[model samples]
Target: MNILFLTLAKISTLKERGIYHDLMREFSSHNHNVYIVSPIERREGQKTTEKKEGNATFLNVKTLNIQKTNFIEKGISTLTIEKLFLNAIKKYFSKVKFDLVIYSTPPITFTGVIKYIKQRDNAKSYLLLKDIFPQNAVDMQMLSKKGVLYKYFRNKEKELYNISDKIGCMSEANVKFVLNHNSYISKDKVEINPNSIDLQLVTDVSEENKKKIREKYQIPYNRKVFIYGGNLGRPQGIDFLIETLQAKSGDKDVFFVIVGSGTEYDKLKNWFDSFKPENALLFPAIPKSDYDLLVQSCDIGLIFLHKDFLIPNYPSRLLSYLEFKMPVLAATDSNTDIGTDIVKNNCGMAVHSDDIKSMINAIDTLKKMDGAKFEVLRQNSLNFLKKEFQVEQSYFKIIEA
Candidate 1:
């Protein structure tokens, strides 16, 4: 079968290790011809380009900067992406007949593109529901529910859902949220298809090498390093993260590493400058290869979500921590099941994002855990990753639909 996948993520090649890349590679490995329509954001200085890696073809549509920009530009870019992508697809992929169409959510403006493929090729459409929008914007208070913008996107959201043959939600809560709110969506049409990655052999770092890594980063080798590496933005509740850091100012045994760039990077940098907490280190985003090595040296992986989120957000960053055999610590909103799943697997602990004391307590608990218990948690982390987040499972979920 020939498959067409759509995403806003700028995937340059199928070799990149990410959810979309890994999933498309899985389809290609199964002898399917996978074609991806991804954007080449303004920073890349490209008009429209096409490339192929093995069995997969990437059609890079030129697009405006959507992420890490001012609100006005971001909004304009988001609204315009669908038309740009649709035009690119028609120009480049006119001859190719797609058997399956899979796309993710962020901007739900892809109804026209999906409808075109479904009607032109009689393709089965699948919505990889990574995000629930407009309402999420409302939850963050980014947009007023009564505003015209909100109404427009909300209508687009429903149209996208209505066009999908299946809606693969990231968690049970997400599945429930969509069905309960949409009312028009069939219960059976939605299913749990969580964030997943293709498993790779993670190298084991020797104690000597680990020590060198810590020394290179000025991190203490004796302390347990807790690292948070991903987008640092509003949805992550950056203010609460600063408050938590300030609350744990005197702690000497636990080390913190915050890495990643976003609109909130300056806010975090300002806090780091003002406090200069000896236990924490801040850095901008690093290469994926380097980040993986850093994860291997860390003892704990950290996840944060805003307490205001009504939508259940499952961050894909958790998989990297698990792949590195590090137990996780997720401080998230009540609605998200990420924290619950981590604790249930006996791999880590989850605390409500608003509760700084509880987060500090979780750190204390990690510091007190014995070697035997830590090993169990480490093993549990890897086991859970293999069972729940393997990309092959997601491949089957889509193809079988």
Candidate 2:
């Protein structure tokens, strides 16, 4: 089968495999033809507009240059690219028969193109959702519930939901949330298809490399290192992370290293500067090989989510931690569903999001865990992942569905 997948992400080379790219590669390796239409925020003056990687092809759209002045301007620019890119793809591929069209939503507005694909090729459509929109925005107070923008985005979200032949939610709570909100969507249509890492690559980092990484990052070989890497933004509730840093200011040996960029980077940096918890280190994003090496060097991983975001987002970063045989210290609430998984698998401790005392307690307990017990916990997580989160299982299930 030939599938057309749509996402608003920049792709230069295929080596930096994330969720969408991993899934597409899975399908392609199984002798399926997969093409992607990825929109970007900038070009960086690249010479090539499109490229191919093995069985998969990438379509890079040239979009308008616009500086966002406000929320309205940002929304308009996002939708404009969606309209132009989707239309341009349809026009270019008029003669090609696409068996299925899979579109993931964050912008929810792009489902308009899914409707068009279904009509044009009679293709089955899948909504692989990572985040549920306007509601998440509203929960974050990023937009007012009564605003015209809220209603517009909400209506678009519903339209997107209604268009999918199958809906792949990132977590069980998100699946349940969809079923409760839409009478048209059956429980069977909404199912768990959580984010995953390329297990092969994730498992390939060597112990020797890990030691080298530890030395490179200036992480003391004798101390416990807790690492968090990914987008640091609103949903992460980084202010509370600063609270964790402040609470741990006197601790001597434990190291907390944060690596990534987002809107909250400056805020987190400012707080880090003021506290300078002798142990905490801050750095921007590093190369994948270097990042993987650091993950292996760490003793524990950190996962954070806003307490109010009842919407479930199983961070893809968790799988990488599990792959490295490092236990997670998930700082989130009960509503996150992540805590449920951690407890079920005996992988790590889950602390209440707003409770600084609880977080400190978790940190202390994690610090004191016996080395052999830590290995046991890490093994349990690896077994769980191999049994369920492997990319091969995802390939079979998605294809069969």
Candidate 1: list runs displaced more than 4 Å. none
Cα lDDT tens digits for candidate 1, 25-114? 899999999999988889879789998888899999999998887778888998999999999999999999999999998779999999
After the best TM-score superposition of candidate 2, give how far the Cα of residue 214 lies from its true spot, in angstroms: 1.9
Each model's backbone clash number? 0, 0
Weakest lDDT window of 10 consecutive positions for candidate 1: 66-75
* Candidate 2 lDDT, 129-231, residue by residue in tens: 8878888888788888899988988888888888887888877787888888778877777887777656774564466776777888887777788999987
Model 2, TM vs. native: 0.94
**Against the true structure, what is each candidate's TM-score?**
0.98, 0.94
- Candidate 2: worst-modelled 10 consecutive residues by lDDT: 64-73
Off by over 4 Å in 2: 43-48, 64-73, 201-209
Q: Rate the local accuracy (lDDT) of all candidates.
A: 0.92, 0.78
Q: Alpha-carbon error at 191 in model 2, in Å? A: 1.4
